[model samples]
Target: MTFLHTIGAIFIFAPFLAFIMFVLLSRKKLKRRSIGFSADLTTFLLFISVPVSVESLWGLEISFAVAVTAILIAIFLLVIEWKKSKEIEVLKYIRKTWRLYFLLLSVSYILIWATGLALTVISFA
Candidate 1:
């Protein structure tokens, strides 16, 4: 595999490993907050990985696929958040950690998309 491919693999898979760790470590606490955080993290990783995997296996353009998947996931999350906004308890925790959540999502997408863009550019070279 090339250097770009290796970086792409890491960008796609690292979150998955972190998710597993979150699950394992949170078993002791097992609170709703931890569970919710883990779920959101998992969702984010899944959203990022689907397109990256498709591009890797099928030789599709990464930038377009990643962008589409990211937008779709953002819309889906927004809808879910809107529907659940009435739940004060859930909203409280979500609001408290919203920054962290956004940061994670932003970083993951940026890394994946950057790697994808690099790979695409290399392919055309």
Candidate 2:
């Protein structure tokens, strides 16, 4: 239980975790930072962190929300691509979907922390 709480505390601030990991990984392996690789890696970390953070924040497991959000974002991106070109570009579609997820999840992660902090503050007051 204590171990899990420690991990929860770390992942609840996953942006910092992701950034540190990215920096160290890039420094160890590549001389120059690759924006594309960084984005993809950060997205993967955010995906993992979202559910963990949500559960830690409110004691609610929201892995379902994360899964549904991913599916919806993919569908939304596909629809936009299909409308513009009347066909799907597999590679482009995947990139767009992943980037969109990163965008939404990053925002959501911040909001979750902010709300958690607000709730704690209010409770103490």
Candidate 3:
């Protein structure tokens, strides 16, 4: 792969790394602040990367698939939280993190689109 492709790959998979870090730190209870940051960053990255990764891998046209996946996950979490008597916690979490989600989603969409445009221009030249 070229340097651009390498960079794109890193951008695409960065959230997965953040997720691993979050899980590991949370498990060991090593750093609460870092864990929170990682968790939030992971969610943001996943929201962005999932669609880009899907498009890149499958050449699909739909972008809302990631949103659907997120909704499904939220529903699943809601069910679990309901059973635990924390029914509103998921909504609260979404409210708190919605900005991060929106920012990442916008940024990731732009980055992926720019990369694709650049690649197209390069190919045509």
Measured with C-alpha atoms, the lDDT of residue 101 in candidate 3 is: 60
Per-prediction TM-score: 0.41, 0.76, 0.45
Structure candidate 1, residue pairs in collision? none
Model 1 lDDT per residue over 41-123, tens place: 66566556755655665676665755665566656666676687865465654554454444555566556657777889999
lDDT of 3 at 40: 66
TM-score for candidate 2: 0.76
Best by lDDT: 2
Instruction: Give the top-scoring candidate (TM-score).
Output: 2
10 residues in a row with least lDDT, candidate 3? 95-104
By TM-score, how accurate is candidate 3?
A: 0.45
Q: Candidate order by TM-score, highest to lowest?
A: 2, 3, 1
Candidate 2: deviation at residue 18, Å?
Answer: 1.8
Candidate 3, residues 28-112, lDDT tens digits: the string is 6556665555656566666757576657745885567667755776576567667878546755757544544645565666576
Candidate 2: tens digits of C-alpha lDDT, residues 1-80: 99998875675456657566666778767656555566677887788787888888788998888998789878887888
Q: How far off is residue 106 in model 1, in Å?
A: 18
